[model samples]
Target chain A: DTAVSQTPKYLVTQMGNDKSIKCEQNLGHDTMYWYKQDSKKFLKIMFSYNNKELIINETVPNRFSPKSPDKAHLNLHINSLELGDSAVYFCASSQDRGRMKQYFGPGTRLTVT
Target chain B: AQTVTQSQPEMSVQEAETVTLSCTYDTSENNYYLFWYKQPPSRQMILVIRQEAYKQQNATENRFSVNFQKAAKSFSLKISDSQLGDTAMYFCAFMKREQGAQKLVFGQGTRLTINP
Candidate 1:
């Protein structure tokens, strides 16, 4: 069983188009996060959502929004995607906010032309 | 802000040999966690090993072990009898112990190559 799974393993889209990435965790986690790895392989947190609130990094642009339909799912939607948006996005989940061990899903490689 | 640094941008090891990857972090918080994650060509982020801040003893999992120096704020990973499948991008990460501090501060990553 896949503990964490993400859809659209690879995505290609135009610069101005909007795109979305879907993530689901069957591990019954209470916290989910989104991280981006640039071409340099520098990974940084974009957003984190728990059962109650969504915590976002100020560095992330407003075009990106994270929606957690439930504790097990966290979807990211990017508006007016730019060339800079071309990177690998990873979804991760932890048993809870207190649990430090996180399980990551196979990343989604998004390429914006 | 907490930051994880992997000074070595790349490393190589021969099959059946051992190699060490160094990592250092800067943080003001005393309670936190350190982790080593491996991402293979398939691009799946796999947790290789983990170390708790308060634990003075290093953590080891079979062939993977960590040298965690809490005072020095250094955590290094040692791989024994490296295999070709060990070739991947290894990232060091830090997480605060506080509840909901789930965001991981990751290093740029060090590309490890296991030669046959």
Candidate 2:
């Protein structure tokens, strides 16, 4: 069984289009996170949710929104996608502890044409 | 704000050799955590090792280990008897010990190549 998984491993769309990436974790974790890796392979935190409550929000654009329906699910929705949004988005989950290790899902690579 | 820096953008070594990837971080907090994640061509992020700042002992897992210098704010990953499977992009991450959820600040990553 997969501990963490993401849907639409690869997404290709034109600019001004809206898209969403879904993530789920079977590890029964209370905290979830979203990270983006740009073309330069630089990884940065975008958002974090704990027990379905918003916790950490980085300096990401307002076009990017994260919704956590439950503790096990965290989804990213992008409105008016741009060419610069082409990158890999990773979903991770961990226990509600600062020192706990986070389990990462297979990233979703989004390409904007 | 916390920042992680990986000086070497890329590195290569022969099989059975050893390689060390350097990483340094800047943070005002005394207690934090350091982690090493490996991403191969498949683009799966795998946790290789972790180190807690409060502990003085280094962390070791199988062939992977980390040298953490708290005073100097340095964390380096050393792979012994490197194998072909060790080829991947290694990222150094930092997280502060806080009350609630923690966010990881990752470095630019270092691409490691193991040649046979």
lDDT of candidate 1 over B1-116, digit per residue (tens): 89889999999888999999999999989878899999998888889998889888899999999989888999999999999999999999998743564668998899999999
Q: Native-vs-model 2 lDDT?
A: 0.94
Residue A81, candidate 2: how far off, in angstroms? 0.7
Interface RMSD of each: 1.5, 1.1
Going through the candidates in the order shown, the clash numbers are 0, 0
Chain A TM-score relative to the true structure, per candidate: 0.94, 0.97
- Per-residue lDDT of model 1, residues A88-108, tens digit only: 999998865454798888999
lDDT (CA) per prediction:
0.89, 0.94
lDDT string for model 2 (A1-113, tens) is 99999998999999999999999999899999999999999999899999999889998999999999999999999999999999999999998744469999999999999
B-chain TM-score for every candidate: 0.96, 0.97
Off by over 4 Å in 2: none
Q: Proportion of native contacts in model 2?
A: 0.76
Over 4 Å off, model 1: A97-99
DockQ for candidate 1, please give it: 0.72
